[model samples]
Target: MSATPAGSAGAGDGVYRTGYFETRLAADPNRAVVWRHICDYLRRWIPADSDVLELGAGWCDFANAVAARSVTAMDLDATVLKAAHAGVTAIVGDCTDLSRFGDGSFDCVLASNLLEHLERADAERLLHEARRVLRPGGRLLLIQPNFRLNPKEYFDDYTHVAIYTDRSLTDLLTSLGWHVEHTFARFLPLTMKSRGSRLSFLVPWYLRSPIKPLAGQMLVVASNPAR
Candidate 1:
């Protein structure tokens, strides 16, 4: 979910172009391996039989790798449909308005490197919408760049408009009726483009390591409380 300049084409203007995907985020087999490990780590919060929905699922990496009963990947980029793995349902739509999905339609909602692409208001709306589509006790998982940790490079991606630290993100989720379950301020490297991310085999070890080096991304897990 990259930001388009004002008066530019609708969603996916600045980003989501075929060139952006081909160049900025080139297809890498190693990325799939990284996502596989990430999905395994995330599985603790996401049951194997859970129905999952990934918002702004760029490349559908998590959607394709995660073990789930059902997986739906939604992004403004049409390329998502092509990136989706077999059995993964891909749709191009605005994440802020998930009206296409019924209330409590998902057991878990995942968003990675997405919220910052939206304006503050839209980010909040997306969060609320995510909550609406999640079943009671369902979880919302997020992996986002922590501005507090990477302030110098936080805005390196021109699409990033909103800033959030672990503290701020937890506060926002709690204010929106979510019970935050976990927060790791320094979970992963700031970007997949980082040199460290190239070491795919080391990712699983990194996830377990207490002393993470070059970590700038934050992971937040929140659950919907019973009504």
Candidate 2:
């Protein structure tokens, strides 16, 4: 991926530095372990040899753990540079504008707990760009808070400017010409800050279980159709 100019005016760097991760996302070690398990489960859609790009890659948990041929982590915050692992490339820029990457540059694009941070319009642009950067038949994976399941806590994060349920997110992706592949309404817990998230060992079991106990997040997988 090539480099692009920063400053998109979405969520600035201050929000990340101001105790957001320090307090709310304090479970760094646990998050890493949990992400590894999550990555293992996600391997069904993401092939090991595929190049992957992770948007809003806070702390680069997914980018670092995913088994991919090449990994690039993008975030508005510069802290991502330090969080990225040896093989991962960290870029500080706006997620909505992926101009730095050429068309069909990656086989997979991931946006976890990211869309909600943008306004609806920006979210659309982000998804559009995500698709534009993916090769034909490439997949776009999203793990987002399901507003329908956790209405009360959906807005707990001050940066959350938009809300989406499985249905709405599916609609949005379809409108952008992505072919919806899978939708898991109840995938993971709402916040990793919770005690339930600390139980990383249970993640594999939870992912396979028919009934998820406290799942408030949804996982949506879409593919870029051949033109």
Candidate 3:
């Protein structure tokens, strides 16, 4: 719906861009239940009072539900302003470029179902900026769809431009100067529409176990080496 800077996902003139977002909006009512479970799972990595910055924060679902000292939810979609909760400071911007914020501005940088949407160059720039803006001991939490596992439906969405697996993602972050702290090869189901999404009660049990069934996503948590 909006013209963002070049090299960004879901912002350019894509055919599905118009109604695609609207579709997500329609599912928000039911998705809120899933968001709550996601927020709870996120708390294990995010400490209280830690400033959090969520990139490509579509609908601000996780941002709104997360508990932190401060939360900034940004996206290229203009809808973020309306979809974001009042508690969240929502802004519209290019995910690969974070020039508006100063260096060392946050304790955690979060991206959920976002990185696969960018080109490698753009994603690298985003990691660079994320590193530049995080304080010492900061963490970058990425919840990405694992193409290795969900190859069949990975490219179903027209916006996906990059593919990453747990190993590849770890290598990418390590080469980018961040230390891989933890990586879960299988974390959550691939799509929000999956049947597991409705069973929020099972989320806690699943995250604590090593064996994740029907898992289609990868959770990678990396931190600055400075700490």
Top-scoring candidate (TM-score): 1
Tell me the lDDT of model 2 at 223: 99
- Residue pairs in collision within model 3: none
lDDT of 1: 0.87
Candidate 1 contains a number of clashing pairs equal to: 0
TM-score of 3: 0.90
Counting clashing residue pairs in each candidate, in order, gives: 0, 0, 0
Superior by lDDT: candidate 1 or candidate 2? 1
**Which 10 consecutive residues of model 1 have the lowest summed lDDT?**
2-11
Q: Among all windows of ten consecutive residues in candidate 3, which has the lowest summed lDDT?
A: 1-10
After superposition, candidate 1 runs with Cα above 4 Å error? 2-6, 11-15
Instruction: Report the C-alpha displacement of residue 153, candidate 1, in angstroms.
Output: 1.0
Instruction: Compute the lDDT for candidate 3.
Output: 0.81
TM-scores for all candidates: the values are 0.94, 0.93, 0.90
Model 3 shows how many backbone clashes? 0
Candidate 2 segments whose C-alpha is farther than 4 A from its true place: 1-13
